[model samples]
Target: MVEADARIRLYEPSDDKLVKFSIGKASMEGLAVANQSACFHPFTLSAWVALSCIMIQLLDWWPKPEYGLLGYLPPLPAFGCWGAVMLYLIDWFNRPQFEDASMDLLRRPDVADIAKHYQRSPSSGFFILEYSGKFVGLIAIDASKDSQSQDTLMDKKKLSSSLPAKKSQGTSSVATIRHFYIDEPYRKAGIQEDLLAHAVQHAFKADSAVKEIKATTTSLIAYSQKCIRDAGFALEKPLGKLGVYGWKLDLVVLRRAYWEKQAAGTVL
Candidate 1:
């Protein structure tokens, strides 16, 4: 009887243990509202569907033919702005570096909640990830029109004093890689890689308009550099005094199409 019980225990693996954290699509609707913040964007399928219908109809019904496609599209700039919003939201949610225990000790849930609410109003859409059904880590991208221009996106005060300016504005929207972290035990696994994979994949699948996905990171964590590289990001030459000084999460820049193309190549 004891042997039989031991055999059964062997067959049944523990449930709470961390399993594979692979890259998967997040259902923006299932995102826990409490975790919403400027860094995390969550949208339901129904809301997305409704927004799409309204935008498509409005775009198809423009009165003036002079602007061509732009004229036909919805005059509501907010409605037309979702692509960039979704991109940043996902990026923020998957930011694993932000989830350090020291940072969490300083961060309060109430503050995070308030921030999330402001970020998820009808005008925006945020993206995030789920670990064991908990909002363990997240990445958010805001598509608001009032964002800063390239010359001053990452102020020196925020990071190393010597980093160079990394900015581009071919379009009106900007993509911010807002948040990233892995839960305690999950960090030991390859959750970071999975998170990055999903983020780049979603950026590519979401819109054709996305030109680049930008982020910052410290010189530390050689793994992070590798992760960005595996995802197809190229490192810019070190910035002036910034290279001499060290900081956490030095600002890094990556493109969606580049990583997506490489990811797709592997599947083939």
Candidate 2:
């Protein structure tokens, strides 16, 4: 069984290629799946249907022979602003994902440098979940993001620091889940769930000041949101929308007090 071979451990410099392959593939696939999921929303579908009907209507405006011959297609680019509207709409939807520096940190040989971001704070770390000696998934924590949500959105600006951009300014103690991804084949085995558990424990164990752990998920990823909810995080607030589709992301917080209470009053 895949479960028998499952192991969750810290990331290593040597895992570069495997990390890149898994992260990029899974990240892109997740993005595609999430996009498809968002398109299924009633509003999105209705808008798409309306657009299609408009396009079909426009096709009738195509030049037709005096005999009303078949196969007469319109000069699409010449027709009104539909072409420009589609181009601008696609651009608007695409910019957010590519411009998001934090997301870029998740995909590459560049991502290998993630350890540098965590090294200054023992309370933070990057973790890997391996199955049968192969890297299959990963998760990261950042002490720097204590007072704010993880910077998972794309702004027009590039990455200004090795650390994520949304770190809060304060004396409060919190840890943020910076990145988390598990490949599809290994997702439901429960071993993958331990990755989150391990990360949360490590954050609390490494820093007594860390009174809470927080993560964010978009409405597009209902399964991921459900998993985080089951892990004890409660919705904190709706941050904002992303892309032309307006997928909503929310902050969720899990307090250290709950952990100690669950343990019958033991400190982390």
Candidate 3:
């Protein structure tokens, strides 16, 4: 049983290639979302063409003795503006996909950076699901403060205080699940559920102060949302059309209380 369990386990430094492939797959999905929603802008294309022509003209003139440095001046603004517009378009293409979210930790360009991130933060964890020694899926958990407002937290505190004493000690920290992905061939095999459970367990083990586990997904990704919901999370909020799901770890406190009570009884 231990040997079988070892196949699906936490990510190691040697699994860099697998981690890169998973992140690339997730990035491609984000790019696909951009491509689908992309709009045609004739003016933007025309501006780019116009700037290119001016830059070419300036370069041609710069070789002439009379033009000299004066030729360079004419193209500087055009070049700068063109570069800015190109960057804007690139960002615009990707912005709608992420909706200005903070998943940058998962979308890192370098897999080594991601590995370094997990190594630096003892409170963070990454897990992979493997079959026959080949990695097939991946997920990660990150520590963060609750995004809820102070007033909302206060309200929650008041409500919890009214509950039985065993359940009143709520935690303020949160663990967020990110970059969850499964290979196409491995889909629909219940691997994602196991990966999620492993991620949550790893998070709780890594940071006992974490009071909740949260995840966010777009409605378009029905399977992803279903996997989260099936793993005992519930919809906590709606970000436009996107859904934020969370699982409160109140049971963590209750379980500790029960264990302490048993210890006290034994002592008595």
Q: What's each prediction's TM-score?
A: 0.40, 0.67, 0.50
Per-candidate clashes come to 37, 1, 0
Ranking by TM-score: 2, 3, 1
lDDT of 2 by residue, 34-78 (tens): 455555567655665567557667665545676355535453444
**Worst 10-residue stretch by lDDT in candidate 1?**
4-13
lDDT of 1 by residue, 50-156 (tens): 67667766667434569776765454554446645644554455343233322432232211332442243222223444554454444434332322222222233
Segments in model 2 whose C-alpha atoms lie over 4 Å from true places: 1-4, 20-30, 43-95, 98-112, 144-172, 265-268
lDDT of 1: 0.41
Alpha carbon lDDT of each predicted model:
0.41, 0.65, 0.56
lDDT, residue 134, model 1: 51
lDDT tens readout by residue for model 3, 1-268: 4454425676777887768766656645644443333323454556676776778686662333467766456555665777677656755656554543324433332233556445434456677888877778888765533222222233445767564523112333666665788877777777777777667666666657766666766534446667776655656656553211111211111122332343356523
By how many angstroms RMSD does model 1 differ from the true structure? 24.5
For residue 148, give model 2's deviation from the true position in Å: 5.4
